[model samples]
Target: MSIKNKVISTLALSGAVLAFSAAVSAQDATPSTMEKTEKVPKRGGHGDKHKMGGRRGMMHGIELSEAQKTQLKAIHEANKPSESAMSEMRELRMAKRAGTLTADQQTRFAAIKAERKSKHAAVKAQIDSILTADQKQQIETRKVEMKQKMQERRELRKQRKANQTETAKPVAG
Candidate 1:
C-alpha cells in the first residue's frame, strides 16, 4: 500500500478509538446525575463551573445566601456515596466496558443506580426547601431557556446531516 493509504488507515483507526471511548464514558459523565458512579473528570472540569449534578446544576443562575450555600454543601457531603461503594462502582464500570459483567454484577449495578436516584431526589428536595420562591422562578426560567437552546441545536444538527447527505450524492457526467 502507498504511504498515503497507510496514513489514512491510521487516522481512521484513531477516530474509531476516540468515538468508542466517548460512547463508553457518556453515561459515566451524565450531566443530570448527581452521584459520579464512575471515575470521570471533576464536574466543573469542562469550564462549566455551575453545570454540576444535583441542585447545583438545577440552581444555575439562581443566587444563594451564604447559609444556603453551606447547607447545600453539607447535604452534598452527607449524601456522597461511601468510598467502598465508589470503588465497587468503578470496578463494575470497568467490567462493563470489558463485556465481562456477570448477571450478579448487573443486579448489583442496578441496585446501586436505584440508590443513587433516591439519594439524588432526597437531596434535591432539601435544596428546594432552602431556595426562595424568587430563586426557584429564576431557575425555572433558566431551564426553559436551556431547553429552547437544546432544541435549536438538535435542529441545526439535523440540517447539517441533511446537507452532508446531499453533498455526498454522486453526480452523473
Candidate 2:
C-alpha cells in the first residue's frame, strides 16, 4: 500500500476501535443508585427504605414544613402500589435466578416490571410537580453530586476486584 493509503487505513481502524471501546464501556457502566434502587432488591428486603430516606433527607434540607411533609407522605403513600409491584418483580427475579420460574411466569414478571417502571415515572413526576423551582434545582444538583460519588465508589470497587483477580493467579512453576 502507498504511504497515504496506509495512513488512511490506520486512522480508520483507530476510529473503529475507539467507537467499539466506547460502546463496550457504556454497556459496562454501573447503574446509578436511583436506577438500582428502582430496579433491584434492597438489603433486608426493604429497598424502598433508601428511597424514603433520600426523600426525607431532601425534605429536611429544603426545610419542608409539617404541612408539606404531610402532603409528601400522602403522595408517597399513593405511590405505594408501584413500590409493591417493584418488590413483586424482585421476588420474581429471585425465583427465576433460583431456576424455578416457568416461561409463563417470566412473561408475567416482565409485564409487571414494565408496568411498575411506568408507574414509578408517573409518581416521580407528581413529586417533582410539588417542588418549587429552587427546590427542584437543589434536588437536581444533589442528585448529580450523589451520582458522581456513586460512580467514583463503583470505580474503586472495580479496581479492588481487579487487584483481587490479579492476586488470585497461581505463580508459574
- Which candidate has the top score in TM-score? 1
TM-score of each: 0.64, 0.60
* 1-173: candidate 2 lDDT, tens digit per residue: 89999999999999999999999988947878788779555566744546556644555477565776677888878777756666877888899999999989889998987887898898778877778888888878888888898899999999999999999998899
Error of 1 at 72 (Å): 1.3
Give lDDT for model 1: 0.85
Question: Which pairs of residues collide in candidate 2?
Answer: none
Taking all chains together, the TM-score of candidate 2 against the true structure is 0.60
- Measured with C-alpha atoms, the lDDT of residue 172 in candidate 1 is 78
TM-score of 1: 0.64
Give the least accurate 10-residue stretch of model 2, judged by summed lDDT: 47-56
Candidate with the greatest lDDT versus the true structure = 1
RMSD to true structure for each model, in Å? 16.2, 23.1
Q: CA lDDT of each candidate?
A: 0.85, 0.80
Clashes of each: 0, 0
